[model samples]
Target: MIREFFKHLPASVDPQTRDLAEQQLVGYACTRRPDDFAPLVAHLDSILSPDGDYDEDEDEDGKPKPKKRRDAFFYL
Candidate 1:
């Protein structure tokens, strides 16, 4: 899911994890079909710039919370 990739993307994550996330994102970015790629970009935008309010102090299992919903969906 996008949340997993999003989690691995932050600089705080281990370098190996970030590298794998980057590989997944970069591989998808090279897709020949714009239609297939668009949702990934849109989903990233949704997660990065979510539309609703958030409680910065909130944490789930000691990790920052992932947003609950978004309009876009990414496909592998």
Candidate 2:
């Protein structure tokens, strides 16, 4: 697993294995997924800083609300 690779990467005794883990980490880090980010953007508003953004469903001012911007997220 990636966590195992990461654990060994920092202090592995074998040079070849360490090099392999480094290469694998790079490959995983660069990969991207395709999906809209409204859900995450909304959620991150809480995760990044609690007492988050405006209510998505409410429109007290009578103007249409803007959509949340999409962003990348890694499973690791």
With a 3 Å backbone cut-off (N, CA, C), the pairs that clash in candidate 1 are: none
lDDT of 1 by residue, 3-64 (tens): 54464343445667556656766788776465776667556545544543243555857887
Q: Scored by Cα lDDT, where does model 2 land?
A: 0.42
lDDT, residue 21, candidate 1: 52
Residue pairs in collision within model 2: none
- Model 2 CA deviation exceeding 4 Å by range: 1-12, 32-76
lDDT of 2 by residue, 1-76 (tens): 3343333222313677556545644564456332332243334333433433333564678876774443334442
**Which residue runs does candidate 1 get wrong by more than 4 Å?**
1-9, 32-35, 41-76
User: After aligning candidate 2 to the native by TM-score, how far in Å is the CA of 70 from where it should be?
Assistant: 32
